[model samples]
Target: MRQLLSYGLFGVIFFHLFFPHNISAQSVDTVYFSLDMTEPISEGWLKHGTEIVGIRGDQSPLNWGNTFEASDPDKDGIYEVAVPFNLHSDSLLVSFKIKVDGVNNPDDGWQKGRNHEAMIYQGVKNKVTLKWADEPPQAPTTITGQVEIFRDFQSDNLVPRDLYVYLPPGYKESNQRYPVLYMHDGQALFDASEIGQEWRVDEAAEELIRAGEIEPVIIVGIGNTQNRFDEYTPTEQVWRYELNRISSQERTTFPEAFAGNYISTEGDTIRFKTKHDTLLTMIPGGQFWQPLIPESEHAFFLAQAGITFTFDVKETEVNQVVASKPTMGGDGDLYGGFIIKKVKPFIDQNFRTRPEREFTSLGGSSLGGLITLYLGLEYQDTFSNLLVVSPSVWWDGQMIISKVNELPGATNQHIWLDMGTAEGEGAVESAKALNKALLNKGWSKENLNFVIEEGAAHNERAWAKRVPDMLRFLYSKN
Candidate 1:
C-alpha cells in the first residue's frame, strides 16, 4: 500500500508518495535472499524479513520501515524474497530480522537484541543463503575481572552516554588505586551482542595484570553516539581540491565549446561551478555512468550525514571544495574535551584514580586513535600516557603531523603507535612518517613505542591481540 503526500519548498509544491511495502522494484540493483525454515515453529507463527533499511547496508534506519514479504514457493518451508536498491556505497552493512506472524511482542522475534549482519557487495546481483538462527547472539566468556555497565551517564560537556568500567582482579578486595585507560567505541569494544566482533579489552587487561607485565589498571570504555566521526577528529572542517590541476596541454581533453562556462582554469587547476534555486538534479540518462571524463576525474566521495559540503569560489569562480573536517566535536571539543574536562573528573571523583597525568592514559583505534592523540597533546597537562592503534594520520590531509610538530621539545609523555600490514601500504608509510616526526620533535626512543603487526587487519580481534603489548608499554612501572 502507498499513500500520497504533499510538500512545498519556499512556495514550490510537489507530491510525494510513501511506500508501505517493498520498494525494491524501483532500485538499480537487487539482493535475492533464500532462507531455510524447515524446522518446526518455535516462536513466530508466521515469518517475514525485516532489515536495517538504508541507502547503504548499515544498521542505520535512514531508509527503513517496510518489511519485505517472503514465501516458501516450493512448499519446502524455504522462504525467498528479492530486495532491490542502489547500495549506499561499494558495500552494505545490514542486519535481518525474522518476525512472527502479525505479532509485535518482545519475544515474538529471533535474534532480537543481537541480530545477524550481512555485507552486500555493490554492483553485483547477490544470491544470499541463510538458515534459521537456532540460538541468540554468542555470549562472552567469563574473564578474570569484572565489567560494570553504567547507562545514561550525564555530562554537561557531552550528550548522555554509557560507560563500561573494567576492574582488574582483587580491585574490590584491595584499597589500591590504579591508572586508567579511556577508550572510545564502547558499544563495539566489549560486547558481541552489539558488534559481531569485540576488542575484549577486559580480558587483555586482566591477563597482563595477572602476569605482572603491567600494573593493575582501570579501563573505561566510553560509548559513542551516531556522530562518531565528528566526536573523534579534532578539526571542524577539511578543505581539499575536488578537481586536480590539469595541464595546459590537456585542454583538448574537455569540450572547448563551454570552456568559460562549464569549465574554467584557475592558474594550474581546472574548475567547475553551478548554482540552483534548491537542489541540483542531474537529468535521467545523463551519461553519468559512462562519461568521456578521465577515470580519475570521475572518482569522488559522495557527501552524507555528518559530512558537510560547500563550494569555495574566489571572485565568482568556484574553484575549491570545502567539507566538514571528519572528526572532533565542540562541547569539550566534543569527545576529547568531554573526556578531559568532564569525564576525567567524574572518574577521579567516583573511582579510586591516581589523579595525576603520569597515571592517566587515553587510547583507541582509527578515528578514535586520532582523537586520542589530539586529546593527549591538547591536554598534556592531564594525560602523560597515550596508546594510539592505527591512528588516522591521513585525516585532514595529514594535518595531525602539524599538530605533532607543535609539541614542545621535551615532555613527560609516553606514546605508542601501531599499525597492521594488512591495513595497506599507505598505513605503513604513514605510521613510519608519524614515528619519525615524533622522534624529530624531541620524543625519546624509550618513551615512544611503534609496532607493526604481521598479517593483521583492522578490527576488534586484531586490536584485542595487541592489547597486551599496549598495556605493558603504557603501564610498565620501573
Candidate 2:
C-alpha cells in the first residue's frame, strides 16, 4: 500500500507502507535549474565539449564543496537539473551559484557576484535560469550626472593610475563651486568594476542630491594599482615570526646577559643563542622581518612561548634576511603625497571645486578604508570629512586606534565610520575600539557617526547599501 503524508502548504511526503515493518519516505518538493550556454559557447569562452554543467548551493545535495551535475538530455543549448530538497517548514531559502566542470573545488567554475538566492516553497517546483560567470548580466548604466576619466594620470610619488571624477547635475549649467569627496578603489565605485560587484556611488550620490538629502558635491575616485597593499598600508605587515630554538635535549647554558643576542643568518637558517644556552634556529621560508614602525630599526614581537626577541640584522646580512621577509609596506605616506600634490592640483585646476579643507573629504573601504583614516589624520588640514567603511583596524595591530589616541585633540572633521556584524568579530570589535578612541579624543557625537549594520557583509553590495547613508551623514544639508 502507498501512504501519503501532507504538511499542508509546507510540503508533501510519500511513504511506502509495509505490514508493521520499515518504511521509506520521499520528498515531493523539487527545484529545477536551467542554464543558457549560447553566449559562452558562441563567444568561444566555453566549448560544449565534454565539460559537464552543474549547480552548487548551500542546501543538502547541493553544497558549495561539490557540484551536482545537470544534463542536456535533448542536446539543446539549455541544460537542466532537478534538485529535491527535504522540507521541514513551509519554505526554504537557498543561496547558490552555477558551476561548470566543477568537481570538489568551489571556485573551479563558480559564477561571480553575490550568490543568487531563492525562496523554495514545499510541494512547488521552482525553475531558475542562470548564466555563466564568463557572461554575467550587464548591469544597467546607473550612473547619473557626468563622469570624466583620466587614464594613466601621472604621479611623482606613486605609479600612474586612472582617475574617475563624478560631477553632480547642474554643475555644467551653473558656475557654483562644489565640495569634493575623494574615494579610493575607483574601479569598484561605478557600474563597471574589476570586482564582480560595484558600490554604485554615482547612483547613490545622484539620487541623494536630487532628493535634496545631501549637498551636491563632486567625487574623485582614485584607481588602485598592483601596489595597493603597499600604498594602503601605513606600516610593514609581519607575515609571521620565525624562531630558531634548540631542543631542550640540545640545550647549552649561556649567561643571562647574552639573552639579548642579535639575529644572524647562515645560508637558509637563522641562528640565535638565547640565555637558556639553546641555539634558536629559524628557517627562512616567508618574507624577511622588518620593524613594524618607521622610527625603529628593530621591533619586538612575541613568538612561540613567552620568549621575546629584537629583530636586528646587520647591514651586511640584510640581503640574507631579504629572502626571508616579504615585501614591506609603509608607502601610504607616498600615496597620500601623490593625491595631495598631483591629483588634487589637477582637479582643483580643471574643475570648479571648493578647494578649502572644509569642503574636502576622503573615503574608502577595507584596506582602502585603512588608508583613508591614515590620510585623514595625517592631513587633517587638507580634509574636513572622512567616510571610513569597514576599515581593517587589525592592520599593523590596530595602529590606527593608537594614532587616534596619540592625537592631542580631535579636529573639526566630520567622520562616518561603520562596520557590518557579519564581517567577523575581530573587525566589529576593532571598529568599536576605534569608535571609543575617537570619542575619547574629543570627537562629538554630531561629528562622528558610527554605525554597526546587522547582517551586513564586507563586500561591495554592503558598501553600496551604505553609500546613501554615508553621503547623508558627511554632506547633510543640515
- Which candidate ranks first by TM-score, i.e. highest? 1
Indicate the TM-score of model 2: 0.60
Per-residue lDDT of candidate 2, residues 393-445 (tens digit): 87766788889999999988889999986554345777888999999999988
Give candidate 1 regions above 4 Å deviation: 1-127, 130-144, 239-332
Residue-by-residue lDDT tens digits, candidate 1, 8-74: 1100100111122223332345677776665533444433221111121212221222234456646
- Give RMSD to native, each candidate: 13.5, 16.4
Model 2 gets an lDDT of 0.68
Give the 10-residue window scoring lowest on summed lDDT in candidate 2: 9-18
Best by lDDT: 2
